[model samples]
Target: MLSRRHFTAALALATGLSVSGLALPALAQTDIKLTLDWRFEGPAAGFLLAQDNGYFADEGLNVTIDVGNGSVEAIPRVATGAYQLGFGDINSLIKFLDEDPSQPVKAVMMVYDKPVFSVVGRRSLGITEDPKSLEGKKLGAPPPDGAFAQWPAFKEVAGIDDSAITLESIGFPVREPMLASGDVDGVFGFAFSVILNLKANGVPEDDIVPLLFADHGLNLYGNAIMVNEAFAEENPEAVKGFLRALAKGFADAVADPGAGAAAVLARNEILDINTETERLEMANEMNIKTPYVVENGFGGIDEARLAASIETLKISMGLQGNVTAADIFDAQFLPPAEERMLP
Candidate 1:
């Protein structure tokens, strides 16, 4: 007895047609390479959870998630097809597309609805919660850090006078240490990450101050799941299925961050379960489960807000007026809102 695939091949061979013409994709698993914006920390549990629970497998996908150097680094990796999908800052994606509208990449899912971009500083070093406090301050900024990349606009919206402020070039490894040692008054990075790193460096909680760019009226979206435009065009269903699985994964993570952190621990035993769990909870409250997400469900964006964000980018990132919000994000790949609701 010939299997359906063999029968389809036989029929297609006789009919002078391709096997695909005889049968649509059924149980065939598509291969996907996914790049994460950063290390396998607490926030990554959602992606890991989906993989561990076989959500991607159930969706007929063989997905491999890789740790990325930075959120900005994932853009080219996905654009050039070195990876089929990635989690990265959508603001950076906007800049990438603006430089060349023909780039084969676009955001498919909104993970960090409010964004985690922040300038974390220590109050003991003359820094405070007020964005205006950054004036005359020396701040550490990693060149590839997603949060630092938003400085131009962040400074503009936050109304900080950079003429008096100095930016110190630093690496990711030293961002928190530099701030903890008071070598630099503040650092540009994700809010939760910088906070956690400072805590690990022994900075007191009372001294740590995270000034989020979004709260200063940036209104920009944050990290999102981006796809290779070519791959998405070729396998639309696979993309949809991948997003569906991620939605479930994130929901589960939100429902129980302890389990989510456990998933992260399963990946890297060196990580402290307590620290990772706290990290996941912080991400859930600050970036993921925003009022908008709670109301509209997850993995979707507001067209008007996205459009306004592009306007903000004009001043912040110096976009070339080459692409619009619609050009950067495609909501068609997301599952239905009802299916994306968080716990």
Candidate 2:
């Protein structure tokens, strides 16, 4: 007794047709932009993995990772909405806060807690045993943009005359050669990038001792995850999604280094990644050594740690009259331990 029209429509409805009642499937993931602290290299393993393994997509995000010239530009770029997120140092962030309190930036997660900067010195220069030995020695360092700007605090803590050391303005590429050929006593450099590479090149570790900035009162976060006030407020879900994917990437990198190195290499083919041992070591250091990065957990910011960094930044950067940590940083985006899934 069913008419042809009714029969066909009833069959369509029974066959899972759109009966004007059921909801449609969810849409695809959203896209996001993230910036890195340094050029594309092995250090950016976690970020590379997140993109390669579709972690961001899994979290409903499409991530675009941009290479940063340095922390100086990257942090402010994020703070000003040039990018949605940034990875860099706490010192730069503190400096920015001091310069302009209006453009407050907050770290959503920590990456490297340990200070990577160090004073690379030759043993022949009588720079041995500890930082105190560097007193009265002709110490060399990279230019103002280099780590030397933070050396004042270290020198003070080490009991060396602020003027006892001669800080040469040799750029980054010249650091190793200047020290090797005896053009200078040693150089200040990022431990992982310069010092570690030197060691890997058959240079004896004892030949060059790294006076870590952290040991000499230069404790600050390195390679942190930060965002601007506006982006953080308007697009919190996007920020959270990016962080979530990054957290998984970090966890994966620490858990399996072989895969991590591959992830890094995939992002930047120019990296001299031939040394497997060095690459693994770098990954481990980034994950475990830094204070900002949690033990057995994702990166989380600590107020006490931030307070310490604030004081260090003020003294180290000679910004006593310039800025405060509270001026530049906001703690709101800093997810709690529960959110970080810390063990």
Candidate that would win on lDDT:
1
Runs in model 2 lying further than 4 Å from the true structure: 1-29, 138-140, 144-146, 200-202, 270-277, 286-296, 320-331, 334-343
lDDT of each: 0.92, 0.67
Shift of residue 173 alpha carbon in model 1, Å: 1.0
RMSD of each: 4.0, 5.1
User: Residue 127 CA error for candidate 1 (Å)?
Assistant: 0.6
State the lDDT of candidate 2 residue by residue for 265-300, as single tens digits.
766666566553365567456434444345435676
Residue by residue across 1-343, what tens digits does model 1's lDDT show?
Answer: 9999899787776656676545534545799999999999999999999999899999999999999888999999999999999999999999989998999999999999999999999999888878999999999999988998899998888778889999999989888988988899999999988998899999999999999998888899999999999999999999999999999999999999999999998888998899999999999999999999999999999999999999889877788788888999999999999999999
Off by over 4 Å in 1: 1-27
Clashes of each: 1, 5
Give the worst 10-residue stretch by lDDT in candidate 1.
Answer: 19-28
